[model samples]
Target: MLKYIRPYLLWTLLSPAFMLLEVFMDLLQPQLMSRIIDVGVKNSDTAYIVRTCIIMGLVALTGVVGGVGNMIFSTKASYGFAKDLRSDVYRKIQSFSFANIDNFKTGSLVTRTTNDITQIQNAFSTCIRMLIRSPFLFIGGIVMVCTISWDLALVVICAIPVLALFVWFLLTKGRPLFMGMQQKMDRVNTVMQENLAGIRVIKAFGRSDFEKQKFKTANDDLCNASLKAMRMMSLSFPAINLIMNVTMILMYTFGGKMVFNGALKPGQIMAFSNYVMQILFSLTMSSFMLMFLSRAGVSVKRVNEVLNTQPDVSDGTNRDAQVTQGMVEFKDVSFRYPNSGGDPVLRHISFTAAPGETVAILGATGSGKSTLVNLIPRLYDVSEGEILVDGINVKEYELNALRGGIGVALQESVLFTGTIDENLHWGDDSASDAVIKEAAEIAQAAPFVSRLTDGYETALGQRGVNLSGGQKQRLCIARALVKHPRILILDDSTSAVDLSTEAKIQTGLREVFGDMTVFIIAQRISSVMDADRILLLDNGEIIDTGTHNELKQRCAIYREIVSSQLGEEALKA
Candidate 1:
């Protein structure tokens, strides 16, 4: 953080320097006014009065210029600091693995990046301006008052300890409440994100009222926490004002008696009163700044949490390992989700997919089928044992190189908002038009795509909401197909398409990518029947593995699934 400030060191230093200049000009005015009243007005000297007035005007102009300079430099330093911090935080998040992301969660990270950083930025600007100016004004005013009359200055000085104690109390008690408010802000953002993402489901199930209630609950929590923190802060105004007013009254009552006794001049008494107000005003501003500082302190801590966290999954030093053959092997691999206390999702799972072979994985829901294929790309590392790609440990390959060799279309097909051609280019940005159309044809997406008014140039809504479920799935597959990877993993990506379309896609894949190793995870028995080999998984372990006919004759689970999907007569046939 300090390193970022180093670049703007000139502005950082200059801001405070100008702020001190502004304070110096402010202090000079009170003494000048006193001389005008005592030496100029009392003696009825017009020349002396005019000369003092001219000097005061010049001082006021100088103060204005110093103020403008302070504002400029302070804004440059603070806004620049925030920009660097925000960019660094975003870069750190990009480096995070799936496990690292899970630890912080989306809502908290959003709050840290946005609201927390804003808070810190505002405080930093205030610190540069008020934090420097207030102390100089307060201490300078006190010194001027002491020169007027030590006896009267004592009354002003006596109020400092009491005001300091009260301010300290407010700040100490306010820090935790402010921290709680920031946390409630995270909860509110989380509720909002979940509701927006799942709004369709909420409306389909007629749960709008339920969602509204949930949002209200989160909103109220944030409101209540905000009120609690603000309530503590609100006390500072009246309390500091009350002390200021009392100190002023004391100065007037005591100093009048001194003037009558000829111990202090009438002009001195007036100047002393002005300086007292300046001291109190500076203290009041300081108190407000302290409250803001405490809140900013909490935000600083939250931002640092992200900056300081090292990613659990780091890049490998071995950048030269090339994946030649698409041979994938899971060697006694066991895996569990990070922070999940339950048993491993895949336990002692071992399998092998030779180059140029189509191996399909069939499993019940929650049987770790998707988890199995995810290991091939090193999306998540295994809890125990190792996964190898082309006989090299997956961890040993450079992440970009490892992922670049394989193309995956996940179970939930996601489409970005773009034209059909633009979305397809994600697989291979440099792919020619002929190559894109060929990949689309292989994924069985060309028919629907051609029917649209703009054909391949048709624009899509977010997540391809304009397209039907089957159409979206096909487009995702097409996107992956454009990569022409050495290995392809389709995790039930074809489930939404009709049986005929699915069969055509499988046939097209076999013809176009006959030599590429393929891993398919599917629930439909018909989907995996033509694979070179099939593995039946149950509860994170491989229950059986064989070709279609071989599994039907010997594996009870395989037989039952085939019977359920195709009927007993069809299986017997």
Candidate 2:
């Protein structure tokens, strides 16, 4: 449709102009061949022969120029359109929420952006050049034949309906098969991506064979779908050839009689025969252009699906929701991922972190601790009730402003393949070296980092694989600290380090940032025991919240957790 092609209308039209010129030149060829046979050879007119030959040479040269021009235009249009579409798709992806992104696997999206877009580009290029050129040549050839001899043109016309039927058959059958091929490609991409990304997990579990079987199923599906499409495409050529060869035989049989009866010249018969074959060949090529079009129709549908999905999180009509003093409050908030029907990940959560106080969250694994913190940044919007950051609905504030006001450290740390300095700069690009060093010390990362050969400039492997788990965690903490955010979240940041090292990091942060709305999520009771307040969560709801001494008497869940870690005698004391 025009939606895809309108981006390149000027070149799209320009490419076809050259094709029309080429078709005119092609019509001249058959006429020139007739002149060579009748005037140049038969009568031995040497001057006439040279004059016609020169004209033919000029037309051939012009055809070559037009063909090159068409090719150049074709390339520009398709590549430029693809470039815009690629950027559009990527920008659209940026608009999506965590809930939206998690619905589709990352691998399938990569394939749609890359391989699927390429398929559409190829189809567009072919449609613009071949579709126009072949039709022009076929129609022009027929008109030229009619002028030369009406009886000869009739022989060509007789085969037109048969070619149309063959083309129609190919279109209806091949379209659905190509769509299946594209779907199969998505499955193949998913399996290959999983194998590559989880290679370490597979080896650790010794499940290489299981991964191979998954890949094989996807691969086999792709192969079968491709073969089915090719099988449908194969029907096109032989059917056209049968019609072409039959028409050629009829032309020879009919034209020979006219020649013997002194009605048509032998040279005219030869020219008419060449013209008939050209028409048939051009029709055959037109069929191929149609097949590419049908295949691309399916690809366009797939690309548009991604383009059309409205992001779950949108920057809507309401603007500039008030932000005041970095106060984060969760009141009866419940959040469930969109895929979940009504099972809340965090249920009836209630908390208030004053601008200058630190709140620690303690729970066992899968206790919805991280889910609670995610609300502050609005990564996944709450399914029921409201979450307020800075006295406004987190949804109402401009998303970047809300996210910018807070800093978060995830349970598992991540770092890009870059120098230590570059990783730190992700927190704040304008940070000075002294500030970065200060933050690193607060993370308990300075001692080991200063010993590295290049220190801040040392190259990190992909995802910072060159570093130990504890080192990576420390770097993540430094990245967050460099932000110096009003509201800071440490989601199990110390789980990777020794108890002594964690205590040191904790002291350094308190000394520097000083009770700046910190939320520490931890398994160790000692980590959160001395906070201004502690929230104890089980399942998705907060069961008890208090100072450690207060919770020891009131909350059974808190006592059980304390007893498990420090023993009943320690709790009694």
Candidate 3:
């Protein structure tokens, strides 16, 4: 946080310097008023009154200038600090691997980046202004009060400890409540995010009422938590006001007696009262600033948690290593998610995928087929064994070099809000129109894309919502194709496309990307029937590995699957 402030050090220092000027001007006001009342009025001098009045106006104008300067510099320093911190946090999140992302909820990360940073930024701005002004005013007011009438000053001095004790009590109780309030905000955001992303699903299932209730629960929790913290903080101002009012009453009682005894003049008592108010008002400002700091303290810890996290996957020392042949191998590989405390999701998975071959994977739901292919690009590291890409251990290759050579389209086809051409360019920023159209043709997406009024220039909705499911899948495949990767993994990418279109895509892959190693995960028998080899996975292990026909002949599980999808007549063949 200090490092962020350093860049704007000039502004940071200038803010407090200007605030000091304002406090000095404010402290002069009471003295001038006392002189006008005591000297000008008592002597019956009209010119003296006018002269002092003009001086007071000039003093106020100077204070205004100081206040404006303070506002300007403090705003600059605080906004700059927040910008740098937010950028670093976002960049750190981008560098996180799947494993690291799993450690935090998506909503929690969003809150940390946005709301938490905002809280700290506001607190910083308040500190720059009030932090300097309050203490100076308090001490200066005390000095001025004692100079006018030391007996009245004693009344203010006694009131100080009571105010201090009240503020301390609220701050101590308020810190934990503020922390809990922020956590509750995280929960509300999580519920809202999940609901928005899955609104269509919720509607389809007729669960809108249920989702509304769930959101209400989260929202109510946040509202209740905030009220608790606010209630505690709200007590400080009134309590301090009550104590200050009582002290003022005591001042009038004692000072009136002093005036009757000719020990103090009426003008002196008036000035003394102003100084005491100034001191107590400064204390009120201090209490509010302390509350802001307490809330910001919790925010600081939350933000630090994100910035300090070391990503589970990072670039290796072998910065120059590149994947040349698209050869991927898993040797007795086994993996379990970190902290899962359960059986490995994949076990003893050994295979070699050579260039120019298409290997298809078949499995039931949760059978680890997608997980096996994910290890190729090192999305997750093998727990008990090793994975090699182009004969080098995956951990030995630079992350960019390794991932750049592989293209992956997951079960979920995610597209951003952009023109069709822009989304395709994500795979290769410098790809030419000819290369893009050719890749689209190979993925069977060109015809539909060409029919759009804007063709490739057609703007897409979020996640390609404007496009049909099959259209979205084809575009995703086309994007991966644009990468010209040496290896491509299509993880049930064509699930939404018709059988004939899926067949055409499979044929196009063989014809256009003959030298690329391809791994296909599909539930449909027809989708993988023509592959060079098929791996049948069950319960996290490969039960059979062979060409389609060999598996049909040798594996009972394979026969059952074939019979179910292609029918008993196909199995008899």
Candidate that scores best on lDDT: 3
**TM-score of the candidate numbered 1?**
0.97
Please, what are the lDDT tens digits per residue for candidate 1 over residues 437-548?
A: 9999999999999999999999999888899999999998999889888899999998888999999999998998998899988899889999999989999999999999
TM-score for all predictions? 0.97, 0.96, 0.98
Residue pairs in clash, model 2:
none
Residue 375, model 1: lDDT of: 82
Provide the clashing-pair count of each candidate structure. 0, 0, 0
lDDT of 1: 0.91
Ten-residue segment with the worst summed lDDT in candidate 2?
315-324
List the candidate 1 regions with Cα displacement exceeding 4 Å. Answer: none
> Candidate 2: misplaced stretches above 4 Å?
1-8, 316-324
Residue 343, candidate 3: Cα error in Å is 2.2
lDDT-based ranking, best first?
Answer: 3, 1, 2
Better of 1 and 2 by lDDT: 1
